[model samples]
Target: MAKPFRVDIVSPDGLAWSGDAEFVVARTPEGEIGILADHEPVMASLAQGVVSVDAVGGERIRVEVEGGFLQVLSNQVTLITDRAVIEK
Candidate 1:
């Protein structure tokens, strides 16, 4: 079983998501990046693309992030965004 990490997705408006995830994949200025529990620390500028998180139940939740900054530290991930929408 994979360890779960805290992931928070936020925009200028407010927090769009707050939960635990096994993995998170998103686009950064450089390219696509994947984060797992106990991942190495990182900070990067994000691009316009989809941000997906694998939940405990193995279900994937995706959201569109227009532009933002992503910071990963310890077992926590923080997303600061200009715009984002939950993908149906």
Candidate 2:
């Protein structure tokens, strides 16, 4: 299993979610991408779609985003979007 990484999501309004996650999936202009711990650094423009985060202990978090940017570096993931809402 991959190690957990810190994940932080933010929108124009404010911070949406912050937690430790094992994996993440998001839509980008190029296509969908999955992130794992210890992965290579990346920064991409996001497409309008749902962002899925697999948190520690098998919790799944879903967020709807209008548009944003996703960045991964040093085992930290950050998402900044124009708009975002966490799904119940």
Candidate 3:
């Protein structure tokens, strides 16, 4: 099993998600950023798109995110945005 990282998605309105994820894929200005457990430090500007995550239990989750910033360090990923809606 792979390590899990903490992924927090916050919108200016409120907290969107706070949980553990095995992997995450997001659309960034540079293209796409994929994060796994214990990934190296990284910072990228996000674009208007969908942010997807593979849950610890293997289920896939996606959230619509507006333009924002993605910060990756150690085992943490902070997604700061102004708008985000979790897919049901």
| Candidate closest to the true structure, highest TM-score | 2
| Candidate 3 Cα errors over 4 Å, as ranges | none
- Tens digits of lDDT, candidate 3, 1-88: 6789999999998889989999999999879888999888988899999999998999888999999899998799999997999999
Tens-digit lDDT string for candidate 1 (33-67): 99999989999999999999997778789989988
Give the clashing pairs for model 1. Answer: none
lDDT of each: 0.92, 0.95, 0.92
- The candidate with the higher TM-score, 1 or 3, is 1
What TM-score would each prediction reach against the true structure? 0.95, 0.96, 0.95
Q: Judged by TM-score relative to the true structure, which candidate is superior, 1 or 2? A: 2
Query: What TM-score does candidate 1 get on C-alpha atoms?
Result: 0.95
* CA displacement after TM-score superposition, residue 9 of candidate 2 (Å): 0.4
Scored against the true structure, residue 57 in model 3 reaches a CA lDDT of: 91
